[model samples]
Target chain A: AQSVTQPDIHITVSEGASLELRCNYSYGATPYLFWYVQSPGQGLQLLLKYFSGDTLVQGIKGFEAEFKRSQSSFNLRKPSVHWSDAAEYFCADYDSWGKLQFGAGTQVVVTP
Target chain B: SAVISQKPSRDICQRGTSLTIQCQVDSQVTMMFWYRQQPGQSLTLIATANQGSEATYESGFVIDKFPISRPNLTFSTLTVSNMSPEDSSIYLCSVERQGRDGYTFGSGTRLTVV
Candidate 1:
């Protein structure tokens, strides 16, 4: 079975500080990884995705993710955190049927 | 990127009632999916709505409980039958754009079964 794991449930970081959210996946084949962010009372917005190209993928809202095949992980990273960056982040991978299997999600709290 | 519109943004329904959520896409999509996100939890796929055929439900989900309909490539509906307080959650509709890696999601319908 394909599964996604987000180790951190909640993380707090100061504004202008760097951020990194860890994500790991369990799959037999090459995974199609994605990162999405959801603000309170809003819909999900796609941050980035790694299908079959470069390990480092850039996404909207100054977000980026690196897919590490060796570790079966695709973690999201940002150089500077902002107050608007406080949202729930979700990591996902596509299953055999091409349906998305999502992680438990990590809630990022940016403190000023 | 595809845009999705979902109606009934928030509703408080009585137990034993049913709620049907509608999803409309700006463009024709190959795949449409329904998902459930419980409070303080991750999103769980409910079913894949296929046009012109029966919807394919994921494990732990059933057609009778969460019936879905996809009459065309750009529209679909998901009905939560015989709702209970346990069924209170945010329901989202997603569309898979062909050749796109990520799916586009709706604003979601927050259903509260009281």
Candidate 2:
């Protein structure tokens, strides 16, 4: 079974500061990694995804993620975060049946 | 990305009752999935709603509890049967769009059981 692990339960960052959220996965074959963001009481929005191209994939909202096969990781990063960026971030991978297996999610808090 | 919508964005139901959540997509899709997000927990896939076929449920999930319907490429529904306090959670419907680029999810139906 494929699984995702987001190490940070909650992350606090000052506005306009750099941000990075750690994510690790456990899978036997090549993994299809993704990052998604969710606002309070809203649906999830796709951040980025890594399938078979360049390890570094850029996504919407100035977010990006790098997929590292060796470390079994695909961590999300952003140079500067705005207050609106505060939300829950989830890392996910595809299962054998092509269904998604999601991480516990990392809650990002932007401090002014 | 695909535009998605879910009905009854939220509902509070008495215990032992049932609620059906509807998911509508703007275009045809190959795969439709139902997921459950418990309070403060990750999204747990409930089933894969395939068009014209029975849904495939995940471990610990039964068809009797979560009956799903995928009538066509752009419409699906999930019914939470015999609700309980434990059933209170956000139920999301997603579609696999653009040949697996990513999943586009509905706004989610927040269910509260009392």
Candidate 3:
């Protein structure tokens, strides 16, 4: 019932170009959102989290995400993606009962 | 944020065998959790490992198949019993951060079942 959806399965961005990954959540109450990145054959690293207050949350590695409650979306954005930023991104939503549900994930490929 | 040290970074085991993964947190946490990530799939909650109580498993996950133990506030273990090829996955341990912090995860253990 409570889940996040990532419409984009894969995205290719120029090495220095801006990148945006969309995430939409379906939950009744206020949602706790988070963004995570995973490299190939590595564990997941938390990018940022949005519990309350700030609509725009900044994260590590020059990444940020804006939580749009009206749209039920928390999308991740980066000004200029580097080669090292090429990895899979996941959007997660925590429900009222403390259950965290993750989206399908988006794989971004940075090209020069 | 709490740091988690997970054991058996990678392992290959034959079918019908079992493997146990351990997670040790740097600081004591109120809530600890386990997750499973199948190849090319997102994470699925396996169970919630709370200290001094039996682990609460999610739908489709049973204690007999995936037993969990939380001996204390900073330690936990998950055992995949009677493993099959389908059980091969990357298992991760997570700790709930206090206040605004969402959660902290471990490096994860990559398991391969032959």
Candidate 4:
């Protein structure tokens, strides 16, 4: 049984500020982690994924995440936040059967 | 990656009525999945549809409530039988492609049961 935990329920950041969303997972083996973003009334879009990589994986929309095995974390980060970046983000892990287990999700609010 | 087209986009149905959601993929895929997102919540896997076989449902989901059909590699349908207000949620279709770590999702079908 694999599970994901997102510590933050909501986060508000100013435009041009650096942002990081925390994600931790519980998996027995090497985990496949992913970050996804969804705007209101829209389907989810993949931000990035980590399978077996160079620790740091870059994704679309200038987002990046680092897979830390020691801490069991894959946190999403952005150098500068934009107003358009306001959306709900989800962290997920896949089981051996390829079923996705998602975190509760974190809603990001970007302000000018 | 595969692109999915799902419909009807949104529907308001009465209690006890059934709704069938369709998912069509642009490219053939090995696995087609169904998910449900309750209000302000994360997505929960409903079932996995495999071509030429029966759908495998997750825990807390039963085939009697959610009947799924995968006629081929690129198309599937999920029907919510004997729906209730608690069944009001966004139903999504997804496909996994080879060599991709992530799954591509359809723009979910929002079902509002009254």
Q: Score the docking of each candidate (DockQ).
A: 0.89, 0.91, 0.72, 0.85
State the DockQ, from 0 to 1, for candidate 1.
0.89
Q: Which ten residues in a row have the lowest lDDT in candidate 1 chain A?
A: A25-34
Clashing residue pairs found in predicted model 3: none
**Model 2 Cα shift for residue A51 (angstroms):** 1.0
**Each candidate: RMSD to true structure?**
1.1, 1.1, 1.2, 1.1
Model 3, runs deviating above 4 Å: none
Q: Give, for candidate 1 chain B, the lowest lDDT window spanning 10 residues.
A: B95-104
Error of 3 at A7 (Å): 0.9
Model 1, range B26-94, lDDT digits (tens) per residue? 998877999999998999999999899999999899999999989999999999999999999999999
Candidate 4 lDDT by residue in tens digits, B1-114 = 778999999999999999999999999888899999999899999999999999999999999999999999899999999999999999999987576577889999999999
lDDT of 3 by residue, B4-57 (tens): 999989999999999999999999887898999999889999999999999999
How far residue B61's Cα lies from its native spot in candidate 2, in Å, is 0.7
Off by over 4 Å in 4: none
TM (chain A) per model: 0.97, 0.97, 0.95, 0.96
| Candidate 3 docking quality: incorrect, acceptable, medium or high | medium
- Give fnat for candidate 4: 0.76
